[model samples]
Target: MDTVPETRIGWTFLTNHARVLTAIADNPSVRIRDIAAHCRLTERAVQKIITDLEEDGYLSHIREGRANTYRIVPGKVLRHPAEAGLTVGSLLSLLVQDESERSPQYAHVKQ
Candidate 1:
């Protein structure tokens, strides 16, 4: 019997903070389940990401009945000193490719 090596991809390369920011940028009203699915992460992971983003001033949420509306602060600078003064928009552009240019697996989910 041969054992296969575990390989990590995509979201694994991103910090939870970055993932949540990207998820919200992709869809402000997106649910936790949907974000987890899209990001190839777990619901708990998504929830934690959201919490971290909110705590760090990168995101804010407003309760709207059964759903929460998220607002991203695009002007917020990244944490790294080398990345200081760079906005969330700049960071997201580097992390996420446009929908039309993505592979088929992600094409349908592209905005």
Candidate 2:
């Protein structure tokens, strides 16, 4: 009997943090549940990531009734020495796609 090779998943180029941030950039008014679903992460994970971003001054939120409206702090610098001078806005521009330009897989994802 021939044994089939098991394909192992490797590290992704982007971290879960970047994924969550990109999701938020796509929709500032998006909900935490929505972000979790879109990023394939737990709500708790998303909440923690959001808190971390806020504490570092990379992100902020304004309470609007039952929902939170997030705002990415503009002109904030990236952390890594290799990515010196890179801004969150620039990173999002590379990762985020306009609603009309997104592929079919992301069509169901809210903007």
Q: Rate the local accuracy (lDDT) of all candidates.
A: 0.73, 0.82
TM-score of every candidate relative to the true structure = 0.71, 0.82
13-107, model 1: which lDDT tens digit per residue? 66766766776776677788767766667999888888888899889999888888899887888888988789987898887668666444323
Q: In angstroms, how far off is 9's CA in candidate 2?
A: 2.7
Worst 10 residues of 1 by lDDT: 102-111
Q: Tell me the deviation in Å of residue 35 in model 1.
A: 0.7
Q: List the residue pairs that clash in candidate 2.
A: none
Clashes of 1: 0
Give candidates' CA RMSD values in order: 6.2, 6.7
Instruction: Please estimate how well model 2 matches the true structure, expressed as its whole-model Cα lDDT.
Output: 0.82
